[model samples]
Target: METLPIVPDAAVGAARHIDEYAAAGARYVTTGQQGAANTQRAYAGDWRRFTAWCREHGRESLPADVLTVAAFVTALAEAGKKVATIQRHCAALSKAHQLAGLPTPTDDRQLKTLLEGISREKGVRQKQAPAFTLAYFKRVLQGIDVERLDGVRDRALLLLGLAGAFRRDELASLDLAHLRFDEDGLVVELPRSKTNQKGEAEEKAVFFSPDRRSCPVRAVKDWLAVLEQHGRTSGPLFLSFHKGQRLSRRRLSTFSLNEIVQLRLGAPYTAHSLRASFVTIAKLNGADDAEVMNQTKHKTTDMIRRYTRLDNVRQHNAAQKLGL
Candidate 1:
């Protein structure tokens, strides 16, 4: 909440204007109806970077002049920043301008033209997928002792993430009533999911039908029992130690999955990788693509195919079947 530094007489007005603009922008961002925590964080980061850049360049706080904004962006791009990065910066600047009731800096036709040109020039692509394997997942689980509260929590998280193919946000949003254990197996109801589905989000369930009695359902049941023992129920499933507050998706970085994968597993993995792992393992165990898609709430069969098909593993298993 630090105030922007005051500049000398020349651009003093502009400096004050910029500071006001930034303050207004923060207020506007917080007022957004779109409640995605990640979106809020990204917007905050982008604007902070833009303001810091302005400070670095000895420019007044407010980017009131379109030309000054243009030159600043150009300098950013010239310094080897990626097109996506530049676009994010532009987006932040545009938002601040809108909040400040100033003219949109990124709205200039010339600026967009330059952005397109730079995008085509770079041809940048998303980074490669994080490396994750079953062995690494096991190691991460093994590292935590089952005696502690956190250990039980981590185990539940890991199992549900792999067994249910849950996104981190969905996992965080779950409540006690979302789960039910009958004699058959475990049933999970996802009331709020991030999909292109209609209405109040589609509800789905995953049944653990393993040959053995002690299956994934058993693991979930045990976790729940531990929670019951600790007198936890019918609230935010994952609570933070900070005054026992309900953990938000914004706290997802503290999940330890990525840290475990990178440090212990020595493999690059993310929350999404667990989703992929579920689809792949289910298919390997003879579950059809349709079934996998249903559990994952995937709308497209084509998208399911990409995750379920472990090409190299299939080929290797086929060879083994032929005794080759």
Candidate 2:
């Protein structure tokens, strides 16, 4: 006969703590639904790190007063931590306190004061991320030999990232069912991504081959055939052979497009460079902003335009036209 499973008392008690807290103000803030999963998880991690710090400092996380928070922030700053990192910890602490039905130490007044002080000290400014270029990508691709697993993985990864304009997280989440190929071309279906439309994570589709004559289309088609040869059907498309599981978002990030560039081409580039390259390449190929936006699934055409850097050929042609 089948038997019912038993629950550990300690585990049950810990869950009760969360349920009691949830009954308070936590439910009003975030339901841990929709796209807030990442936010919630981030806050939770921040809280854990804060609690660990608190224990070392001889204080309780929940019951700590404003003085403790001030001391923590001051100590963090003295330790040479960035203002953003300190703000993350503060945000986490505020959220955790609110959830626990305790008085928030970092209220609006505190947050405003901290922000103003940080701005004055650090000089508030936004730093633009480095963009990827085609030449850099080509150099990276050249480093990989198609005969090895790493090569296969890198080739498949670089193409998917560039062709599909997939985010690092989405890259790790790719499964076999996400791809479909026929005589016409290849279609990649992303059920959920960083930018979801209407609160339902967006599904992305890409037609690399407009008329069955694109190198990108042919490359991905070849990769799919190799995937089939492994006798694999419906699981993570980017598998981590070491773990024998799907690739993780964090792990994928460790070896970014920059590392890929450095490894293959002896240059540094970020993962989003592939995205920029995609936009620029698409535009040069005569695709309009709307067409590129649809492919990239960018919420705004303006943002898409930013990624579509001007190619040298276009610049030279425009210069010649000016002379004419």
Candidate 3:
């Protein structure tokens, strides 16, 4: 005769627990979406470099060993890579290992010490973007002929970028729909930024300048008028041009902003200089850290101090006040 088997009580509870946690387990696939796009891109590129290096050296990359990882970064250091770049490589390795369901060697104690040594040796002073003086800024604006499509767009971009203390991404991400102009001046509704990644409601004001030629508000208005002429009322504030200088619906990239800055200002300057220059100039003109932070949207005063490149020691030094 066939006998019926009895199931243990714990077996039913264990099966129920597995079913209860099924949603959480399924949600794990969305973990990659947690990081910003730029960060994800950097990690991906760094991982490719690391994997290629491993392949060249005949070392395994997926299940990377501590010694191999250490040696890889050492090679990068010997190759004169910056400390930040080397650290990013290690971070990329950690991500790669995590994706493969393995542990990262980057968390190894020896690797941390090596990274500290690299930081000390490399001198953790990152080169700041060169900012413009007010005189030069005015002169550059004066030289641009705003009658053309390219000229107007570039002028508006530069002026708004500087006055608004906007990052490159912020500038590139601008849309006409988010802008609000009042009697005081223009108020930009910033939807997303590096600090506010969840699309918070942050706004920045660009007041009218005493000098109409260099006014951020006026420049933006003129650009809008020109865009109206071209039937571009909404969408990207700064659009790219075609071969014949005809405007396209495509928005300018962050790199394009750098190119515009370098082409207009000089080689040493970049898109970041707009924001940096705002902090430096404002601080020199006696704007406190809080005042500057309000415009730059920086989370801390330390960043303000770092961005303020007041290199004129003779002008800024307290020795003059000491009666020396």
Clashes of each: 2, 2, 0
> Which lDDT tens digits does candidate 3 get at residues 29-62?
1244345556666766676666566556665554
The most accurate candidate by lDDT is 3
lDDT of 1 by residue, 1-324 (tens): 332234454764454455554555565654441445555667766676666556556565454466767777788788998877888778767766665556776888887887888888887564534434566666676776767655566666666777788876677677788887777677777776657323364555655646332245766666678667667765656544433433332333435445532443345666667787888777767787788887898879897776653647543265767765
RMSD of each: 6.6, 8.1, 9.2
Per-residue alpha-carbon lDDT of candidate 2 for residues 56-153, written as tens digits (9 for 90 to 100): 66554455577778877877777877777778778777766655566788875775686668767866543434555566566656666877665666
Candidate 2 ranges beyond 4 A from true positions? 1-41, 58-60, 63-65, 101-105, 123-129, 182-184, 197-201, 209-214, 241-262, 265-267, 276-293, 300-324
What is the Cα-based lDDT of residue 313 in candidate 2?
66
The residue pairs that clash in candidate 1, if any, are 18-62, 131-268
Evaluated at residue 272, the lDDT of candidate 1 is: 67
CA lDDT, candidate 3, residue 287: 91
lDDT of 3: 0.80
What is the TM-score of candidate 1? 0.67
